[model samples]
Every structure is written in structure tokens, then in C-alpha cells.
Target: MPASRDQADRTQRVQLPDETGPVPVSIVHAEPRWFGVPPPLLLFGLAASLFVLALVLLAVGSWPSGLILLGLSALLTAAFLETARRRPGSERMRAAHSWTSSRLELAREHAKRLAEVQGLRGRRAVIESERRS
Candidate 1:
């Protein structure tokens, strides 16, 4: 049988606070790959251009134009990716948002709660007393 909802929620999940330092105040900078997504229009346009080129080459009975188009397409793709990678100050903006957001705040709160539990372990009375305080 499948697991219950509470067990499913608690188990098989990495506690985010545990991954970082004590107090969990450390910045978890998002990975670059997390922000990277291929532009849909770009993919669509490339497919359409390739299809058109293939049709044109077939009609003209020419291998050279097709080969040249392939080479140019490869070159252009490389250039486009390189340009996108630069991204005009995007690195700085990402760095700023990563630490300033609620994500970091929630991580800190989780860390604080985990620390309280760890500090009060092996003594239920102590846990109750600490809670009162």
C-alpha cells in the first residue's frame, strides 16, 4: 500500500536547514542552470528555417548550399548562446535576489527550529521548560 500523507510529507525530504551552516543564515545562491531555459521562439525559428532550407536545397538539387547552411547554422547557434551567456549584469542581479528574498528567511526559521530541538533533545522536561521560557 502507498504511504500515508504525513509520512510521505516528512520522510524522503532533505531538510534545507541541515544542508547549510548553524542558524541556516547562509546564502543558498541559485545554480546558474536553475535560471537557464531555452527560448521557445528560438527553438521554433531554428526548426522552421532548417525545414525551409531543406526544401529549397531539395528543389535546387544542391548539396553545397545545404552543407553551407549547416555550417552557418552551427556557427550562428554558437554565437547566439555565447551572447546569451553574457546577459548584461544578470549575474549581479541574481546574486542580490538570492539572499534578500523570503526563501532565505524561511530557511533561517527552519534552522532555528531544528537547533532548538537538537539543543533540547534527551530531556522532555527540558523541552517543556524551554518552551515555557
Candidate 2:
């Protein structure tokens, strides 16, 4: 079955305690792609731009310098792709962690009475007890 909008909305919203003096809390969401470009495409673009620059340098200047730039570009492109490969997995993990935490917070809040009435030993009780510690 499809998930309910109410559960989705709870994850989208954040609650923070109000106090006279306390540090600010912020939630940041990472986008799946950088600047709307997928990592592979971005890597390609980086390499292409560098290759073009290296050609221009070779044409206008020296062969050694142009080759250096070309090599640097390749190295950079490889490094970027290596690092970016792990982003999607980390993003998925972060999102799952956030949703579960939100559900637990809601259980602690809305299920307090229900838990007490049900003799205080269920998922709700676990949530409430976790909140106290």
C-alpha cells in the first residue's frame, strides 16, 4: 500500500524547543545532483572544458604547459567522480534516518496517553522511555 501524506508531512516539518537562550538548530537537505547535473555528466563537462582549455593553451602557448593542464584535468575529473559515487547512498541513508527519527518523535508526543492506557508496554512505551533518557 502507498504511504499516507500525513506521515510524509511529518518528516517535512521540524519541531524545535523554544527557549530564551539556546543555540540555533538547522536542518539541511542535500540535493541528489550537483547544480541539477548528474555526477557523470558533470564529470564529462569538467573533462571536456579542461581538454578544450588545454588545446587552447597548446595553440597559444607551450606544449608542456598544455599537457600539464590536460593531465590535471583528467586527475580532477577522476577524483570528483570517485567522491561523488558515494553521495547517492549517503543521501538515501540520511533520508531514511531522518524519517525514522521523525516518526519516533511523533510516537513520543501523540502516543503518550495511548501508551499509558494500554498498560505502558508497547512500541509507544519504548518511544516515551527513550524520550526521558
TM-scores of all candidate predictions against the true structure = 0.27, 0.31
For residue 115, model 1's alpha carbon misses the true position, in angstroms, by 54
**Pairs that collide, model 1:** none
- Collision count of model 2: 0
lDDT of 1 by residue, 38-57 (tens): 54335335644874785688
lDDT tens digits, residue span 1-133, model 2? 8766785555555787788787689999975554644455455467668879999999997889899989987776555455445463566544544554466478678788776778756768899989999
Task: Output the worst ten-in-a-row residue range by lDDT, candidate 2.
Answer: 92-101
lDDT of 2: 0.67
Whole-model lDDT per candidate: 0.58, 0.67
